[model samples]
Target: MVIRHGQASFGADNYDKLSDLGHQQSAAVGQALRDMGWVPDRTITGTLTRQKETLASMGFEAGEEHAGFNEYDFQDLLSARYKGDVPDLVKGDRKVHFRTLRETVFQWQADEIENPAESWGTFTGRVESARLAACATGADRVLAVSSGGVIGQLTAASLGAPDKMMMTLNLQIKNTSITKFVFTNSAFFLHEFNATPHMMSGEAAGMLTYS
Candidate 1:
């Protein structure tokens, strides 16, 4: 199973860290997983602080740090293409932000931007490699804490989901949501996507977030 990190410090200078709400969300996820009787035999996370912190908050060791699982740097992509004059969508307005993000991500997929730090092809390759590596562990169940982008890309690639579907999934993914996959011989099949049963009710309801 792969879980997205909790709500990040969106709109902040450093988006790699989580907020207090993020920490609460992570704890709720941990409790949820425990209630579901799911325990990871192996665990991994992206190199980002948010990812690592999420795992730690879940009461699991940060078993591995994989740069391949890191999120594609949207900030870098925006700066590269827009020369730092990004649209207001990224600033605050949630509705407009998603609208613009969807359009911009499609543009990125279409190779509209030049001299990106990592091309779309490279980014996909990295994500695929990371997924394969995680599956190669040969454990019955492995947990990886990553970002929405990486999780969406993995699910999209495994199911042959289209770019638009991937983007939609990415946008809909809630913070600390669980996405499940079953693997056999390095091949993966998606079992679930963007499940947030942990925060469906009670105080956890307020913890639901996407960023």
Candidate 2:
């Protein structure tokens, strides 16, 4: 099972930590997983602070830190593309932010930009490595804590989905959400996508968020 990190300080200078609401969301997710009878034998998380904090909030010790699971740096990508004069559109309009992000990702995937921090192929390949490592443990139940970008790439890789599908998945994944998959020696089959039953009702219902 793959879980997204909680809502981060999106507009802050350092968006690598969870907000107060994020901590509450993480607690809710932990309780929800316990209620669902989830007994994970192994847990994994990205190197990002938010990912590690989310796992800790769930009452789990640090299992492993995988750099491959780290999210692509969008800010750096935009800075490179615009030559350090990144547009201010993402801050004002949510719709514009998503639309612009989608287009930028598409362009990045097409190799239209020169000297990117990491190529789109490289990013996806690392995500695949993270997935492979998660499945290699041979544990019946494995939990992986990561960000939306990594999860989206994993989802797209599982389905052999197109670029647009990856973008869609990335945009749709909610904080503290779960996406399950069945992995075999040959392939990975998606079982569920973007499920946040824990946040479906009550106070947590209003805590559902994506950043």
Candidate 3:
């Protein structure tokens, strides 16, 4: 199972840390997994603080750290693309920010962003490597916590979909949502994508977030 990290301090100075609702989201997903008897035999997370914190908040130990699961540097993407001056539209409002982000990311995927932290090809390659390692593990269930970018590209890779599919997948991924993959000696398939059982009820529905 792969899960997106909980909500982070989006407009705050430090965006790496989780918000109060993020903690609640993480705990809710954990509880949902527990109720369904979906205990993970192995756990992995990206090196980012938000990813690590989300897994910990879910009542799991820090099993391993993998840089391959880390997210693309969005700040750098915006800065580099805009020649180091990100416009207010890219940062001031949530809806506008994401809308601009989608366009910017499409450019990034086309190798248009100048001096980005890493190229789009590099990011996707590393994520694919991480996924292969996870599948090869001799464990029944493995839970991985990561950012939306990584999850999106990984999901696209699994489906043999085009690169642009990552944009759609990335935009829709909710915090702490679960995605399941099935891997055997002969096949690796995506069983589920962006499922949020914990936040599906009327009471928890308000907590749903895509950013």
Candidate 4:
């Protein structure tokens, strides 16, 4: 099962750290996975603090996290895309800026944008490589903890289209959500997308979010 890291501490430069609620969410997910009789043979997580913290909270040691699972720095990508300025508008009025940026991201996914920080071709290639590497480990069940962007990229690849519509659909993937994929001999078959069965209760229900 591929799990996205839980809610992160908002408004922090290092968005890789989980918030108090995020930790609780991670623990809940862990418990749910255990209840489902899913014990992974191996585990992998990004180099980011949040990814590692989430796995640890999930009761997985996941020694020596892999850099292959690490997310591309969107901030750096955005900075480069806009010629290193990353307009104050994005920082000054976050809500509006995010909406605008989301549209731009969608365009990028569609290959409509004239220039993007990282091409969709490159992004998909990296994600595919990571998936191949994970499968090569020959583990029966493997767990990977990563971010929304990475998850979305993989989701799009599984769907065989990394276009704007796919990007928009993937954007709806929530925090701590589980998307299962079966791998054999370097091939990936999607089992599920954005499953949040553990958050059925009221307390846990609040843990649902797409960002």
**Candidate 3 least-lDDT 10 residues:** 128-137
How many pairs of residues collide in model 2?
0
Better of 1 and 3 by lDDT: 3
Poorly placed runs, candidate 3 (over 4 Å): none
Which of the two, 2 or 4, has more lDDT?
2
Model 2: residues with Cα > 4 Å off, grouped in runs:
none
TM-scores for the candidates: 0.95, 0.96, 0.97, 0.86
Clash number for every model? 0, 0, 0, 0
Work out candidate 1's RMSD over C-alphas: 1.4
Q: Give the TM-score of candidate 1.
A: 0.95
Per-residue lDDT tens digits of candidate 1, residues 1-211?
A: 9999998887788878989999988988988898889989999888899999999988887698788989988877777777778777666776776677777778889999877888888988888888878888668979999998888888888888887677888888999999999889946799998999988987778888888
RMSD (Å) per prediction: 1.4, 1.2, 1.0, 2.5
lDDT of each: 0.86, 0.87, 0.90, 0.77
Q: Which candidate, 3 or 4, would have the higher lDDT against the true structure? A: 3
Candidate 3: RMSD over Cα atoms? 1.0
lDDT of 4 by residue, 11-104 (tens): 6777779988888888989999999999888888878999999999988887546665676556655665576787777755657655766766
Error of 4 at 166 (Å): 4.7
Ten contiguous residues with the weakest lDDT in model 2: 89-98
TM-score for candidate 2, residues paired by index:
0.96
User: Which sequence of candidate numbers ranks them by lDDT, best first?
Assistant: 3, 2, 1, 4
Clash number for candidate 1: 0
